[model samples]
Target: MANAFERLVEKMDRATLDRMGKPVLINDVGFVAVESHLIPEMGPLTGDGISLVIFSSDYKPRRNDQTVWDGQSYIVTRYQSFNGKPQVWLE
Candidate 1:
């Protein structure tokens, strides 16, 4: 199987992302292996089809729209002056 870093390198390419259609996140939460698939979101502002990742010690996913009221969604909470306010979504 491809390691998580390899997967990210391949998937994060702009060309790759554009062609792959929208990404759908399905979390079995606590499952042992990773299995990703594509799904169409019913509407906008619900979340996006593309997946954004934030990895730390492990490639723990916080798939699109998966955030709960605990409040760790993709929404940017802070701002920056000169450059992109968005943090490097990956650690």
Candidate 2:
């Protein structure tokens, strides 16, 4: 079972997303609402990138998974969980 803090965080995350997120397409499965952050420059090879926090219950993303956001296509290059949320990096 999740601890109280974890449950609270989940609720807060959902509320924030519901109010602020935009639609994102993942692998053409369907459109999910998420808050995405754009990084102006990622690195030499990857170039610019987008980062978004997501709940595993909503969608679990893997590396190389295709995503479409703001009318641009990208690939999931990496991800790491922080504070019960997965920070997905798209390139």
Candidate 3:
């Protein structure tokens, strides 16, 4: 069972994605909604990758999974849960 806060988070996640997500193909199989952004710089390394936020209920990402967004390909480098959502790092 989910608590009230968790239920609220789920609602907000769905609403946010519905309003702002872009289509992304996962492993060339099907499309899922994701909020994609440029990877942020860490230390002295410049950013040259993509970060994707997607609903966990929609898709569970794994390392090395291929994704295509805006006609460009990317490989998942990392995946973790953020605020009950899935945050994916791609290169």
Best by lDDT: 3
The digit string of per-residue lDDT tens for model 3 on 18-61 reads 88877778887665566655434534535666777765466878
Q: How many backbone clashes does candidate 1 have?
A: 1
Query: What residue pairs clash in candidate 1, if any at all?
Result: 23-49
Q: Which ten contiguous residues of candidate 2 have the minimum total lDDT?
A: 39-48
TM-score, cand. 1: 0.19
Best by TM-score: 3
TM of each candidate vs. truth: 0.19, 0.66, 0.70
Per-residue lDDT of model 1, residues 1-91, tens digit only: 9999877765654444355433322232321111122355633433333223222223333324242222223332322221111112211
C-alpha lDDT values of all predictions? 0.31, 0.73, 0.75
Model 3 local distance difference test score? 0.75
lDDT (tens digit, per residue) of candidate 2 on 18-85: 78777777888655456555544743544545677765456776999898878999898998775656
Instruction: Report residue 91 deviation for candidate 2 (angstroms).
Output: 1.5
Model 1 is weakest, by summed lDDT over 10 consecutive residues, at: 82-91
